[model samples]
Target: MNKAVFLDRDGVINEVLTDRVKFVNRSDQMYFFPGVAEAIRLFNQTFDYVFVVTNQGGVGLGFMKEAQLQAIHSDMITSLQKEGALIQEVVYCPHKPKSGCTCRKPNSKLIEDLARKYDVDVKSSYMVGDTDTDIIAGKKAGTKTVFIGKSDPLADAVYPDLLQAAHWIVDDAT
Candidate 1:
């Protein structure tokens, strides 16, 4: 079985605007946080698989169409590729928060599905995210968890940002 790293899209890989439009309503709104590509590149080097697991509820809420969301992801991936980062896949839940979807974070279905598809060893994988929901999903999926920003008891590790978290994960694996 393969070991992998699961990353959250917004706030972890890219910036999330809290003051302005919270969602990346347009591709132009997509902005990579400093060192994110480099961090992901490190993950690419260390993990058998690197994936993006996100919740884009804005699509179901009509803030943006599914095509618009795809465009944003495409732009994000293209930008990361320029920096030598390769993401194996991007799994997202495109449902409203109240929709009771099993694919959303806090459910672990997204990570579980990816693990099944890739034959990943969930216990050997790491899920990195900035929110409690992300930590919850990772824990439920039985992977070691890294929480970016703020401290969380549920996470196996915590860091100020993705770059630092990436470093710790790589170091701990060795």
Candidate 2:
């Protein structure tokens, strides 16, 4: 079985508003966090697969078009590729938060589905994100969790940012 790394797109791979009141509606709204591509490059080297699991309610809310989302993802993927990182897959829940979607974070459906589809070992894999919902999903999906934030949260490990988390993951994988 392969060991994979599931990453949260917003805040983990890109910058987001600190208030969490906004969403990416266009490619211009997306900005790769410093060292993000490099960190993903490290992840690509260490893990069998790197997946981006994200919640993108902007589309369902009519705030963003599906084409805009795809463009943003394309830009992100292309940028990462330029830095020697390749994301194996990008899975997102485009339904509104009130839609009762089973694929959203805090729900393990997306993570579970991907793990099964890819034949990945949950115990050896990890879910790395910047929110409690991400940690919860990882735990429910039976994977080790890494939180990117200041306080020591519910995750198995915590770091101030994804780059630091990447270092920890590399060390752990070794």
Error of 2 at 130 (Å): 0.9
Model 1's number of clashes is 0
Report the lDDT of model 1 for residue 31.
73
The segments of candidate 1 whose C-alpha lies over 4 angstroms from its true place after superposition are 18-21
* lDDT for each residue of candidate 2 in 1-174, tens digit (9 for 90 to 100): 999999999989887885542567777777777888888889888899999999998889888888888888888888789889899888888898879889988999999999999999999999998889899999999999999987646898999888999999989988
C-alpha local distance difference test of each model: 0.90, 0.88
In candidate 2, position 95 carries an lDDT of: 90
In model 2, the runs with Cα more than 4 Å from the true position are: 18-22
Task: Output the TM-score of candidate 2.
Answer: 0.94
RMSD of each predicted structure: 1.2, 1.8
For residue 162, give model 1's deviation from the true position in Å. Answer: 0.5
